[model samples]
Structure formats: structure tokens, C-alpha cells
Target: MGNMSKELLREYIKEQNFTNANDILNGLKEMFRDVLQEALEAEMDEALGYRKYDGIEKTNNNSRNGYSKKTVKTELGPVQVNIPRDRNGEFEPRIVPKYQ
Candidate 1:
């Protein structure tokens, strides 16, 4: 089961009398979208800078609260991403446009 081919996967599904591949495919697609969204969120975090509050500031500290928003595109379609923000007014995100 660890090294099954695509053809064998289809055969096993057929043998199990399964016909709702759409649901599974959609679920996987959703999973992929979730992962992509996470990547975008992390990108925003890095772009805007982030750090944990430990009651002590480091040598070079830059951290703030983050936010999320929904956006659409013609190629990648729609995505719900977290927009990062900082308190030092030195970070700005460049993904999906600020007005989109």
C-alpha cells in the first residue's frame, strides 16, 4: 500500500464499488488550497515581520498582530490569506494587491 501506482489505486477503488471520486478529489484540492493559503500567510508574516511576546525585547525586535482577508484572481482563483502587520510602521505586503 505504500508504493501503489495510480492505476492500482483506481482498480482498488473500483473493486470497493466506489464512484464518488469527486468528493475525494475536491477534498484533496481543498487541502492543497489550505496549504497554499498557509504559505501565503507565512510569506506575509516574513514580509511584515513577527515575534513572540516574552516580556523581554531582543536586540533587534520587530513584531505585531496579524490579519487575514479574502481575495480573488483570474489565474489562481480565490484565497483567504492572513495579512501581517507591524507596530513599527516599517512593513508592507505586496501580494494580491492592497486594493484587491
Candidate 2:
């Protein structure tokens, strides 16, 4: 994929029917949330040395346990995200660190 063209962006705005500044801000916030969430998931994949559900034996015992709800501050404001967990409690998310 390539960068979104201005014409495509304008078409998207028209389709969304953004009525005011608030609508645009909300859309940007949602996009930020999605990007951050995807980054976190990719980090987990790297830490685990395999993609989710790959069925390959993990070199170590660590595996994806589940997710923990965490709120992180961003320029858009505080956005909630599901931080993936490892069974041994070692999957520290670099994007949204625990102390942040």
C-alpha cells in the first residue's frame, strides 16, 4: 500500500459526513488508537518469536496469556488499549510501558 492520496482522503471525509471539528477530532483519535493497538500486537509477536497461532513450539515456556486493559496518555488524550500478556509476565509493551 502507498500513502493515502488527498483525493481519497477527501472522498473518505465526504463518506463519513464529518459535520464539525469534533467529528474530525474523534476520527483522528480512533485512528491513533488503532495504530497503537496494532503496534502493541506486533511487539508481542516479536517477543514471542512467532506469530499468534503459528503452532510452532516456543523456544521458552512464555506464551500469550491474554490481555490487560491499560489507559495510556497520548496527544489525543487518554486512550484505552488491551495490553497483551505473557504467561511468565515478561511481555513488557515498549509502546505503552507500565510506568507510563
Candidate 3:
């Protein structure tokens, strides 16, 4: 997946004739999922004050906890995302608010 390029994506779309609205929506959903996941991870890093596997000694009591599955409604459709968590449960995400 890391090796996939825009040209390959375009070729796949053309080969599959993904021109219909449903196909476009599905594609957008997938793209949004990837983006949202990355954002959530980044948010976690910022909240924890360290990157994943940074190997730095813990300076604070709060740390990253496992993620929680959440389904959000969007214009594309219902997209499932993994929301990051903190041990102190104080890491509120600004990208997708907890109540939203």
C-alpha cells in the first residue's frame, strides 16, 4: 500500500470504471478514513508530548492508551475511525470533538 502511487490509483479507477457516484463516494470515504486516522495519531502524539516509540523516559504520568472504535456520519457515509485515547482521559481531540 505504501508503494501505491497516484498513477496506479488512476489506472485502477479507469480499469474499474469507477465513475458512478457510489464509487466516488466510496473512494472519498476511504481517503477520509486514512486522513482521519493519521490526524488522530498526530493528535495523540501532541497530547502525550511524544511521538510513538520515542524511547524517551516518561516525564509525565499521562500516556497513550489504546484506541477506541467510532463510527462517524459524514457526507460520504458512515466512516469508522479509531479514536486515540490517553491514560488520564484528558486528551480531547479538536479534529473530531468527543461529543460530535
For all candidates, the clash counts are: 0, 0, 0
lDDT tens string, model 3, 1-100? Answer: 4788999978867866786888877876888899899999998899888998999987789988898888989888799999999989999998888898
Q: Which of 1 and 2 is the better model by TM-score?
A: 2
For model 2, the superposed segments whose C-alpha errors exceed 4 Å read 5-8
lDDT of 1: 0.56
lDDT tens digits by residue: candidate 2, 10-52:
8878888998999998888887899899999999999989889
Best to worst by TM-score, what's the order?
Answer: 2, 3, 1
Candidate 3 or 1, higher TM-score: 3
**What lDDT tens digits, residue by residue, belong to model 1 across residues 7-80?**
98787566656458875665445555676566656665565444344465444556665565655443344545
Model 2: lDDT of residue 1: 15
TM-score of each: 0.46, 0.84, 0.77
lDDT of 1 at 37: 60
Instruction: Please list the C-alpha lDDT of all candidates, in the order they appear.
Output: 0.56, 0.88, 0.87
TM-score of 2: 0.84
Best by lDDT: 2
